[model samples]
Target chain A: MIYFKKVLKKIISPYRIAGSLFSSQYALMLEYRAEIVLWAISGVLPLIMLGLWTGAEARVLAGITKEDITRYFISAFIVRQFTAVWVMVSFEEDHIEGKLSPFILQPIYPFWRYFFSHVAEQFTRIPFVLVIMIFLFIGFPQTFFIPSNKELIAAIIAIFSAFCVRFILHWTFAMVNFWTERASAIERVLMIPYLFLSGLVAPIETFPESVRAFALLTPYPYLLSFPAKILSGANVNLLQGFLCLFLWGSLFMFISFYAWRNGLKQYSSMGA
Target chain B: MAIITVKDLRKNFRVSVKRPGLSGSLKNFFNRKTILVEAVKGVTFKVSQGEMVGFIGPNGAGKTTTLKMLCGLVHPSGGELLVAGHKPQSRNTSFLKDITLVMGQKQQLIWDLPPLDSFYVNAAVYGLNKQEASKRIDELAAMLELNDELVRPVRKLSLGQRMKAELLAALLHRPSILFLDEPTLGLDVNAQSKVREFLSKYNKRYGATILLTSHYMADITSLCSRVLLIHQGSLFHDGSLDELTLKLSPYRAVRIELKEPQPKGLFVNYGQLEEFNGCLVRLLIPRETLTDSITSILNNFPVKDLEVCDPPVEELIGNLFKNPNY
Candidate 1:
């Protein structure tokens, strides 16, 4: 009777299942604290861009001042840390090494397992990223603007949504491993556009009008630059940002689902 | 009733042909060539409830592929398949709950964490309540003698210990059907026997249907009475082990020990000489002529002791594989 009750409870509450997955993965991530810190430190590209853009002659690019560039790049760095997704490497390894077989046999879908694990990793990374943010604020007191309570809530929501957008998009890309062994190579190709257009290197607004238009058309701007603009207290149309995120997130979700269904058909699970 | 059924199941893989040299590689990259390799070619079989069946085959004989197809890991290119009354390729959650598949080469446990942590994760995935999950884990861990090892990281445990933990993780939900692919591979004799004993006990206790594939004959000889022989993606024979032995091996071995030293030539007339020690002789005699030859040897020779037995199970299987007609 107790067993039947437990099964009944499980059928009703999938959030509990996700919560358990999140907890286990969170514990596992905590075991790799040094790696998390190293990864947080590795998002230094925006900081480098900050240095380059704030020079005396480079202060006013596209009607933006040195202080504005500093805030934009710093916010970009923080956003990048939150939105990072490395599930592609994990998927490629699991597929190549035959580690995916066991996951396939489980009653739960593998997508939720991977999703919770990545989310746990991001959760583990938050404190380390917070420390970096504090140091950056202490170093550049004049450039940073303390967001209002309303702005803070909006920024949190936007950043989290951006993380979802990035996660779903990359997860869709990772599904390419189902058909080809060179998925990491393809990821490297995808990273080029993400680096330039997502505001990891420079704010998309600094680019010319034509380039900015193209960047907005792609999903890359919604991932990091749009959220970074929100965190920097820049003027952003909330409705437009929400619309872009919802559309792109749903599109990527569909692609991932379709790829996963087709990939299972083609998956050989080659190695033991 | 059949718990698992497969009919004309087929799986073919498309493999790209690579050229030898750099220029050939360039040309081949531009104009690719692919060939269809059939891993499982119209194989068919049925496993009834509460039956422990051994699936034996040579390397590349599609044993693993067949197991994968039945477990819903790999989709069959053609044919109908069912497990626990559901089409395996459908991969319904209810079907998944009723079945479990364990591969010796693969693991479901998280490598960096303790097996207990993985157990909890699996418990949640399978929807077992905390109390029931702990109860199941404790019971299985005790049966597999994994009390002290469950808390250690999986990588810290030896292969045998880890394999035991893997089994516990797989069986936590008490699946009614199990698909085991080389579950005893790469274990020492003691560990192998322990695993076999645990599996035997688990099967008896739960009345689960097991279809196990293994290269080791001991695993089959001990746990499975019914054996399925597969070769070249075909089921050649399916019956009791005794039946297979009788049909495939038509000869028995006879040994004679003399009170005094015996000449090697003395046993030549009785049967084909297999071994000739100083005071003992061994011969291979046809099953039909076994009693006559034994009587003649007893009456003619100064035999102090005599014994007759069938050939080793490994030797019989080897011979069976060698001859495709059988």
Candidate 2:
């Protein structure tokens, strides 16, 4: 479509702008190589959880084994690293610094630039981190397994939707910048849901029936648990997953738009 | 027709001032105090196409507030403003496509990547074809002397280099109008002159209208024939430099080297005589009385040497705002 081409052109037209973003990201990674290694070390949470879960399976529970635990946790680890929400950090920084005005003046929409840079960084992360997981899967074949083509296709779609859901939700939270001077405190409190409900540390199914039902109704589960579940051959209805994703994505889309519109109304240019 | 017009433009902000101290901070948890500050108060102006107008004021004088309004970066509390036939506050895509705002403190360059990368991204955002965007970039870079710096990371470049790159990025689309806010800030004297020269050349070359705000008088004197002086969010003076000078302080300064030392009382009534030594005195005279004052001085004393010139424009602008009708 012409509209799509126009959007694409805008994204690439400022080649230097786009190039700078990628270069900055790569350079940042280089500068913080040690920090990244430390972060990778903190990913020990999943391994710890794997040990706890495997120890409890004196007899196999839901066909889960030491192998299953390792594979599932590693997959969770890989997903968690890849899907980290940087949009919130940059948005909050710009909002607080009063730098958002310059972005608003540009001929192109700021949202697309933000979206593209984040997506581009993800491509970079694949080589730096995702491939490491791929090799891990190769070494631990008993626990980790690749999905079939049909499931892989479905999971890919699910991952993309999940990414959208994550971006929108994080953006919605970042929009809190308009109302409050310090949004990280608010974001920190809000991040509890992603941890408990999104199956980051444990599967959502393991929760009590009542809590599980509530978690399913929220957007957090779609962001993390859905794709991993599909890849693991979990018995989830394809149509139902698609509908759930659509509903959550639409809900966030609505929230982000409203917040952006309202936020713009109160955007005062700071200083002289 | 006016490319930019503003009427009764006003912008006010309600800022929350957090109370200090542990007890005061605790009280702020339940109740907070807010104050309203008017940044731009009922100022108005009109800029036609191809005009290079300077907007100058003291720090916190709201020069930037008006510039931001024209660029559609901030909405005004009360005003009517149209840039390129579009209401700036609406910031419609079409309106944005035709106008560019370059702020010296803020930049669009990707800090870690070559400025060209940012240019490419802007190209995509503007929907320019590869060839067309590159052609424009090449032209702008060449004009800005940015050929070597274009491919280097922005952070690696000097402040002057970064500014040149920023200008190139903003101009890639060749917008019909430019709103430049302190575009030459922090550059060394040589770089400042280069930037001013490029801006003047660009304005003439493309016939691009420019509305620039800066504390740098040199930038105004070199690049803008017409300047708008703002004070306390209001338009204090809006006219060409010549008109401003003639209207504000139509006076000439007279300097004389006396043949012998003279007492101060003799010259005090004529004007404020600034004497570096007993034999040298400088007198300010109204423009109409310059000839009479010189003749009187010559008749009274043996004038060794003499010179007369108008007061600097900056002094006149300062006087105009201090006493509006003066």
Candidate 3:
């Protein structure tokens, strides 16, 4: 009986399911390596800003050295590449192509498929990112710096957590596809605040105190700024960063499933 | 025992109305107009365990809507539905495990990966162990006559190979009930025959209940002894395939070959002239008038050969939507 139970548990385990899904999704992701390379290249904004900020004196962001700013921007670049979420675009494609129907008919929740798909895409992006970083360090060896072991581990955890928060947040918006056909247009509006406050353009510290405080209130700073700071070996409250990510991730997860239930009703009414 | 039961099932859609022309479009931009469409009126049916029944209907006749409701993809607007002793709209995991829905041309396989990769994913999702999944895959592959195609990318496969692969993916869990919509659409004659054969074999071996909808009459004629003919959002007939053709079509087709030649006009006075060439003429004479029409044509024209039979189900059903009353 114990042997049987273990078999049953293993069969139903999420790890086994995720392993199968990830392997299949990884194979599919590699087929689009050319597209992923271009996507990784497009995330060069932070590196470009690093160059611009390196020349500025202590005036740009108070209480920070030129070398620290360079490390911060490089950290931000890595964080942005790993935590980038595009569930909105993918969900819209599946919704339009009638692929969602097949997904809905299956035994598993459909978002799990999309989740593994996003994770697989991140894996595919790793090689391209390493190449870019190698070019950067070779061209300007002074920019190279090794983060402490603790800092590297914390940043990896933080970046992955931030990805969860961002994925659920964007996926919550993707539910708008069930109401209307096109929801990618809304992504453009989401970009305005995300670009401004996510520390992608510049560090949130450079902003006025009021603006920084406001940005912190939203989930934007936790997504990139907190993780980037940890990666750059800067001092940060690890507990607060993790807590904010957990709280925001939980909130969006609840709202997304609620929207999913209602979205199904609307799906049937859209002419089956 | 009835494994599937539905009563007075209905689906109503509230759709926006868009008028033609620039002026109407401009006016509608300010305030959109909308209307309620009753896509499926009251439809009721039942199928016993291991029974394979055909649900036949034209486009926009609520066939797919009804199937969607059975599989829990679409919630019913009203009425009751019970499949495998569970409410489908609840979408319980147990219920999902007991059923599967397959739609034509829409795929569940990852496009870039080989079908074998997706089969593994599906097996894991359905909680099948590697050994069990591999065993079932081998069995189904032999049954489907699938070989190396499982390892080829899905986009590279022929339409027939892709469809067979789709059936394999869907049936991986061995669901007790199957809901298939246009499963044989856009396939060659040989491919359709193979699918029909496989479905029959699967049903017999596992005693699975099937509710299939298809525009291909051959799919129904061969696989389903019983059929549910639907039209204009209502159930029209529930009987054998032959009975459906008989009820819908009140006319028998008569053909005659003249030794020489005859104008189409020469046959029209006797019955409705469906076809007329120089040597042969086809007519749809009402059953009541079939004898009189044939006699008159034979007595007048030098009939070299004569034939009479009920029209093909394809022809009868093809004209059904045009004459919804029939």
Candidate 4:
């Protein structure tokens, strides 16, 4: 009985439940091995931008070289892959199809399962990403910057924090389905601005001063550019960057929580 | 004591009305009309511990909505509901632990992976250890006769197998109360009977209170002694199946085999003639007048065989829905 009690306690604990979810999701990711490869390949947008920036050297702003652009875009590609959150599409599909009813009925909160699933995808995609990075470095050894130990540590922290912020923001938007059926359309509308402002197209520094200021004011910079900037050894205020990420992450986290609570109240589990 | 009690429970949903065609779609995009649907309107019922109750209703009569509310999947707009001594809408951990809801249309099983993986995930979510969860899975798998199917991907399994696996996933936690909505839906005759047998045995062995909703009359007839009938989002009747039949139908079907060819006109005075062939006849007569009608029919006609029985449960339920006041 004592052993059983211990097991029960362990299983019910949030941390253990999250760990189990992560493991199951990791296994699921393995089953989607081909899809993982396709997703990783999809991150080649930044690499293509790198080619564009390298060819248009005259268009490049002062103090930014072709090699610098290469490193910046490569770091952005890595950050983009790590921080990717497909929760909007998946959540919309699940909501539309009534697949979320079972999760809603579970004892554990449903968000943790979704969170673990995305995190597990990232964990599974790490090796493939590393392989790509290795190939890139082998081809253009001059472009890649090996960060200092301290910088590497800070970059890891920033990237992880960025992933959290992006996940929460995407989840918050996904909750729009609770009120309307056009959540995917809304997400598509939001994606255009996000693509420009999140440094997916170009680094924030490459933008005009006014646009750069506006981008920094939004949460998009902390989600993608800040982490990429950290990894590229760019001259950035580390303290300000971390603080901005934390503030935006907390804001989005609260919004997501609020959205979820309200969403549950409105959720009819219609099809099920 | 009643394990589940619902008093004046209600649910309302606001639905957006969309217009058809490009012009109407554009108009809807600007100003969409909305309507409120009263899915469950002031339904009330109670189920005591270890009692298997059937919540029978026609489509859109709020059976699924009520079940969803009891399981904390859908929130009630008004009224009170208590399941296992907890307010269902609160969805407390203890309350959730004590109950499981199974909807045949929705599944918890991971589609691409073996059911064992999903079972382990449910075990973790429900706070069951590896050893205990495995033991319970084994027991349930054995009961469900899902020996090899547990290891196969859920998508690969037949519908019956998938539903059985879904049941095992739900029951692994050993919930004290089970809310089954259309649990035997979309199954063949053999699979349906097998599912009903398993459910009856499970309830008996575990003493779990079960509230089931199914369109199949056989499901309710075989497993539930007491049933709540809902029509138009209201509880029309709550009693034993026999009581419901007697109350709504209040009639017996007297099937008779004639000794010779009988005129259909001759049997009309006995009762309402339901069937009349060359040498066979069936009549629906009021229960109170059953003896008189049978005696009269026998006295008038040369009867070879005769039997009196209540109308089929399906017909009785059908009549009840058509005219709920009965």
**Top candidate by lDDT:** 3
* TM-score ranking from best candidate downward: 4, 1, 3, 2
For A52-162, candidate 3 gives per-residue lDDT tens digits of: 788775435476787789899999999999988888998888898788887887778988999999999999999999999999999989989989999999999999999
Best-to-worst order by DockQ is 1, 4, 3, 2
- Top candidate by DockQ: 1
**TM per candidate:** 0.94, 0.90, 0.92, 0.94
TM-score of chain A of each: 0.92, 0.80, 0.94, 0.92
lDDT string, candidate 2, B1-326, tens digits: 78888999999988777867998897887888889989898998888899999998887788888888888888789979988989988888888888898888887787777887778767766667668988999888888887778887789999999999989888888888999999988989989988999999899999999999987889988888889888888887898777777877666788889898888778876776655478989887777777888889899988899998778878876765677553
Weakest 10 consecutive residues, lDDT, candidate 3 chain A? A55-64
Pitting candidate 1 against candidate 4, the one with the higher lDDT is: 4
Number of clashes in every candidate structure? 0, 28, 0, 0
**Candidates' DockQ values?**
0.75, 0.44, 0.58, 0.74
What interface RMSD, in Å and to 1 decimal, does model 3 have?
Answer: 1.7
Runs in model 2 with CA error above 4 Å?
A: A1-44, A57-68, A134-141, B18-30, B246-250, B274-277, B315-326
- Quote model 1's TM-score: 0.94
lDDT of each: 0.87, 0.77, 0.89, 0.88
Runs off by more than 4 Å, candidate 3? A2-12, A57-61, A269-272, B21-25, B254-306, B324-326
**What digit string (tens of lDDT, one per residue) describes model 1 on residues A1-272?**
99998777857658768888999899899999999999999988899889888883534747788767887888888888888888788888888999988888888878788888888998999999889878887997876677778777887898899988877888898888988876978778889999988878877877778999999999898888888888888899989998999999999999899999998999887896
Residue B164 displacement in candidate 4 (angstroms):
0.8
Per-residue C-alpha lDDT of model 1 across residues B1-326, encoded as one tens digit per residue: 88888899998999999879998899897998899998888988888999999999888888889888898888999999988889887789998999998889889899899999899888888888799999999899889998889999999999999999999999999999998999988999999999999999999999999899999999999999899888878787789888777877777889889888967777787778989997889898888888898888888778889998888877887876787585
Error of 4 at B56 (Å): 1.5
Of 2 and 4, the candidate ahead on DockQ is 4
The CA lDDT at B272 in model 2 is 65
Model 1: chain A TM-score against the true structure = 0.92
